[model samples]
Target: MIKDHRPYVVKRAWLKFQKFYARHFLRPQLTRLGTGFTFMRPWHVELFGAPIRIGRYATVIATPDKKIRLSVWPAQAGKGHITLGDYCLICPGVRISSAEGITIADNCMIANGAYITDSDWHGIYDRLSFGQAEAVEIGKNVWIGDSAIVCKGVTIGENSIIGAGAIVVESVPANCVAAGNPARVVKRLDPEETFTTRAQFFADPAKLARDFMAWEQAVLQGNTYFGWLRHLLFPAKGD
Candidate 1:
């Protein structure tokens, strides 16, 4: 019986090429690029239609649009303008519409499928609302979980976390965990540890970079392709 060569060849091709980009080029680009951090892959940055400004040490992992619902308008005036602060982590499948402006402060962790918009885009009563909208500001150290929708004109205070699938319609105070469809405060966080800004982290670049690299190694060690490839190319001395 002949071995299945197709699958093996395909696997080798992917492992040799695509995996390297995913591990090195993609990950590093996402990790190192700031206020405007982006993945080199178009799918990773498709909905990022606007000119995004990412601060220092920010991570943005734009995921594939499996459902093909991403529409990044080319209108530079107000179509998409996303601002992310320092030490921020934006996961995959996060859809941010920028008919208006969207501001995310320092130390923010925006999880998968998190959507934030500054405008209704289509107007409240009519479909043809061709105009810029209000800006949404997410304060420092805010952690927005998966599938959270932050609507227009909403201000989320510092050190707050929006729980998964929450739809925020109003302003939330500092040091609180907000959740639900029309997101509300679920719990309050400690003042000391709650609100941390990007200005705080990048104050020491050397220390911050060192710490972040170490953390990245620990978090993505076995998960990254490089780690696996290294193991495959050079087995442990004792193993």
Candidate 2:
């Protein structure tokens, strides 16, 4: 069977176009956009207010309905800041709102529908008045699961994992896994085991990306245009 290289070529060109769009249109808007920052759907990333900085090699996967929102509210006492560190992966429906400050360190992976807020937004009784706002710090190499909420005055330590649907209200220790309504330390990670983070993927991104493309092309070698269309419309079994 004759191999078709058209799909591979088209995909490469589309990726180049997306990168161009992100650099020219989106990068200028942010307070600080570091080098090699990529977004799958850049249009879905909504940035409001100033002092929102994202570090190098960060990837954000956002959609229209599940937009990734990063906002910093101005304060009378001190300025609000939201800083995302290097090689972090932020999924769709991740809303990070800072009234005082919110800092997420390097190599962190935040799953979809996760909310990280530094303030209550409104007072308990006063309603109109703004509630207490404190700095929420998420340390390096943390993995926040789906639908988790990191509330005010919380510090999640390094190499920790927040389980799905967890609501973190207090400080989580390093190398531990936390879960539940008021996220508690359920298990501790083995300190002896060596783990790799997303940062390693971006270390040689160009070579890795080319390798991935080659693998994809090999997989779709005998696939026709019609076959591709059919796969999109009605996905194959076990796909």
Candidate 3:
């Protein structure tokens, strides 16, 4: 309870199983799933209706309570598509529903509970009909904060940051931070400052994997099979 109780071998096996499950089951659902992509709790990642593509080294994390969902429902067939570029991070409870097009460029980090949609789903007067559609283009290294809602017809420029709980209805220019309801530009990011992206973080895939494995092994060093089982059945205080 306090830490991972599973033995090293068991945890390693579980990781392998998750990867296998993602490869055979989840990969088929996506139009294009790039190499070295890590989908933690892949079963909780839901992809509905196609032409949804994700680029290389993408990290998607989902939990049972907060599943990541990507859905495309066009007014007509082939009218909507979702594309995520390289080294993107999609956190739990992120829902991206497209009725037109959504293009997220490289090294974007979409935090937990962020919702990105390209259509209103219902018209203002008719109510039943799908409203107008406009494409949303999120440029490179953009960060969408937790619980932010990006409404229809918004384009977020490169290196822009959307603050937590912001409701974006209009376009955000490059190198700025936008927040609040109707999400106004709060501050301009200094373009001269150096920016480190997720792409750079995952530059060496093999080294990164090795580093994670080493850390896991070290942390789970004293764990045993029976200890793990006991913790699960009757967890102790500070377990």
Winning candidate number (lDDT): 3
Residue 208 lDDT (model 2):
79
lDDT of 1 at 74: 34
With a 3 Å backbone cut-off (N, CA, C), the pairs that clash in candidate 1 are 34-54, 35-53, 35-54, 35-55, 36-54, 79-98
TM-score of each: 0.63, 0.88, 0.98
lDDT (Cα, tens digit) per residue for candidate 1, span 24-109: 54434332234333232333554334365567665555545622123334334544567667788767777777666677887888
- Residue clash pairs of candidate 2: none
Higher-TM-score candidate of 2 and 3: 3
Q: Highest TM-score among the candidates is held by which one?
A: 3
- Output the TM-score of candidate 1: 0.63
lDDT of 2 by residue, 169-226 (tens): 9999999999999899999999688879888888898997789889978866776667
What digit string (tens of lDDT, one per residue) describes model 3 on residues 77-113?
7799999999999999999999999999999999999
Q: List where candidate 1 sits over 4 angstroms from the true fold.
A: 1-43, 47-49, 65-80, 130-132, 193-239
Q: What is the Cα-based lDDT of residue 234 in candidate 3?
A: 94
Q: Give the TM-score of candidate 3.
A: 0.98
Question: Alpha-carbon error at 3 in model 3, in Å?
Answer: 1.2
